[model samples]
Structure formats: structure tokens, C-alpha cells
Target: MSRRVLITGGASGLGLALANAFLGRGDQVLIGDLAETRPDSLPDGADYISLDVRSQQDWDAALAHVRETWGALDVLVNNAGVATGGRIDVEAISDWERVLDINLLGVVRGCQTFTPLLKEQRSGHIVNTASLAGLVHGPGMSSYNAAKAGVVALSETLGFELAPWDIHVSVICPAFFRTNLHESLQGKDIAMEATAVKLITKAQMTADEVAATVLKGIDGHKRVILTDRLGRQAYWTKRLVRPAYNHFATKAGAKLARKTRDA
Candidate 1:
């Protein structure tokens, strides 16, 4: 059966990749984005809607469109978020507010608005995009870390609550993949992003590859999905040896700081 899939932040990056993946599978895919979409970026035959994840009115409108058009939603991908980098003390309060509002609260809003529809149907899957940063806290990513960690926690509790309704929840924890997440960075954040790109380009999975993994995880009913080897390593390292993981993270932070200074 062809599923009805809605993806947030679907104009570009991982969201686009995921939308393409579902479209290729013959599912009816709808993209929800704050800005007008780039037609060239998305695959053909995909639908779109204006969605500002921060607003409840936008969420309601998006869902109403889906309900009116398709009658039900089979999958909801809460994949919209931004990356903000700076030392905890240096990052402005505005940065914190924006990051938390979009990354954490955005997911919260999506789940709250869409879960009811899924519950009524008694069948649906919700995939929330988090990050490896959520599992392994690093320096200079205080805001992103807090927002993603909140997403992880929220998804977990949501999974427990929705289990009875057969509305499955999956939290995706992925390592660095080429995406527009870096485009949001500014000032020293740009340097940090550049350093990350240089270090992880070889090892990073493309957004399309991660999208494939997401579908496979959903098909297999995985509760927690890690998109790449690095993400899995980070999760296990933190779980098995916290002290060693923290030591390595601290060194990596120092290296990034030096690189930022030199840049």
C-alpha cells in the first residue's frame, strides 16, 4: 500500500532527501517548509505546503491539508531544525531561544498536533530527527545540544505513550551528513562548520543515504535509528565508557577551537 508521508523542512537537505526517498517508493509525499521550495531540489510529483514548525496555526493548516487531500497521514517526519554553535557563555540568549524554539519545540508541536490524528486512525509512524550531538555533548554546541537532547527525550516519552495506539515513534540520531544545517551558522560558527566539513566529508553519509536508512529502520520497526557508523560509535562509547568518551570529546573541542582561531 502507498503511504501518505509528510516531511517538515522538505525544501532542501535531509528533509528533501527523505521526501525523495518516499516518493521513489511510490508513497504520496508532502513537504512542509517555512519558505518557498526550490523546485529543482525536490523530486517530481511531490506535494508541498507552507509550514512554520514554531506555530500551531501552521501545523493545523498543514495537517488539515493532508487530511482533506489524503484522508489520513501514514508517516510524519519532524526533520526541521537549525544548528547554532558557540561556547555556552558566548552564545547570545537570542541564539538559545531560536534554536530551542525550532529544534525542540518544533518537534513538540508536530507530535502534539499530528499524534491525535494518528491515534484516531490507530495506525501511523512518527520519525523525529535528532542528532549524534544529542547523545554526545561537545563544546561550542550548547544550544544545538540542548535542543536535540530535548527532542530525544520527548520522542522517547512519546513512543511510550503512543505504543498502545500502535502509533510507532522513531528518533533518528545521525552523525554529520552534508546538509543545509551549516548554512544557518554565523561568525565563528561558520569556522566551526567548515572544520566539521573538512573532517567529516570523507566519513559522512549523504542525506539520501541516511534517508534510505530511515526507511529501512521504519520498515523494521526500530525504536531508535542511528544513520551512520559514527553515530553508532558515539552512542555506544557514551553508553559503555563515559570518561573516555568525554576525554576524546574535550580534545576534539580543543582541536576545533584551534582550527577556528587559525581560520
Candidate 2:
């Protein structure tokens, strides 16, 4: 059966990849992005909606559109987020507010806005895009980690809270991959930006690969989806090998400190 799916941040990167993946499966895909004009790169059959995730007005408009156009929604992917990294002291409060507003509260707003419809229908899936940093919590990434961690926590709670209504929730934790996510990057340290770009560009996985994993996870109704080998390894290492994981984190912190100093 063809399902109605809406993906935020679908103008590019992992969200766009996921949109294409759903379209490939014959799903009716709606791309909700902040772009005023529809992106020319949008795949042939997918529809577009201008949305700013942090705004209640935008979400309300999107909800109205979905109800009018699709009648019912099968899947909602809250993938709109900004990339950020910086030491707590150096990172401005405004940046913290920005990351939290867009990355964490954006997902919250989506859920709050759409839950009524999903509950009424008694079946739906919510996929939230978190990050490995949400779980691993590396140093010099306090704001990003906090925002993504909130997403992870929110997804887990919703998985249980929405279970009675048959609404499934899945949080995606992916390590760096080749994507335009860096375009939204924010930080006080120039070194952090450069490092993020290098890691993203050098990663073995692509957005399409992550999207494939996400599709499988959503289909299987998995609660927590780790999309890369490194992400999975780090998650388990933190859970099973606390001492080793701590050592690795501190070592990475030292390396980052050295890089920052040099820069």
C-alpha cells in the first residue's frame, strides 16, 4: 500500500535521501523545508512545502495541508536540525538558544502539532534524526550534544507514551557521513567547523546509505536506529565498556584541545 509520508529538511542531505527512498517504495512523499521556492533538485513525484520547524504557524499550515491533501499521514520524519559544536565557555548563549530552538524544540513542535491527528488515526510512525553525539557526548560539543540528546530522550518517551495508540517512534543516531549538513553548522571555534567538515567528507557512509538503514528501522518499528558502524560501536562501548569509553573521550578531547590551540 502506498503510504503518506512527510519529511522535514527534505530540501537536501539525509532528509532528501530519505524522501527519495520513500518515493522509491511508492510512498506519497511531501518535502517540508524552509526554502521559499521549491528546490530544483527535488525528485520528480515528491511534493514540497515551505516550513520553518521552530514556528507554530508553519507547523499549523503544514498540518492543514497534510489533512487536506493526504487525508491521513502514515509517517512523519522530524529531520530538520542545525549542526553545532563549541566549548561551553566559548559558545554564546544565543547559539545555544538557536541550536535548542531548531534542533530539539523543532522536533517537539512537530510532535505536539501532529500527535492529535496520529492519535485520532490510531496508527503512525515518527522518525526523529538525532546524532551519535546524543549518546556518545564528545567534548567541545555541549550545545549539539544537549540538543540531540533531548531528541533521543523525546523519541524514547514517545515510543512508550504513544504505544497504546499504535504510534511508533524511532530516533536515528548517525555518525558523520557525506552530506550538506555542514552548511548549517554553527560554532565559536573555527577548528570545530573544519574538523566537522573533514569527518563528514571522509566518512565511508553516505546520506543514501543512512537513509536505507533508516527505512529498514522504520519498517521494523525499531526504537533506536544507529546508522553507521562507528555509531553502533560507540553506543555499545559506552554501555558495556565504561572505562575504555571514558578514556577514548578524554583522548579525543585532548586532541581537539591541541587542534584548537594551534588554530
Best by lDDT: 2
lDDT of each: 0.86, 0.93
Instruction: State how far residue 74 of model 2 sits from its true place (Å).
Output: 0.5
Instruction: Write candidate 1's Cα lDDT for 1-263 as tens digits.
Output: 89999999998888999998898889999999877554566678888888999999999999899889998999999999887777665567888899899999999999999888999999999999998888888877788888999999998998899999999999999888877676666534556556555544555578899999999999988888998887888889889989989899889888867866644
Which ranges in model 2 have alpha carbons more than 4 Å from their true place?
none
Error of 1 at 262 (Å): 9.3
- Candidate 1, residue 4: the lDDT equals 95
lDDT of 2 at 232: 89
| Residue 192 Cα positional deviation in candidate 1, in Å, after optimal superposition | 3.5
Clash number for each model: 0, 0
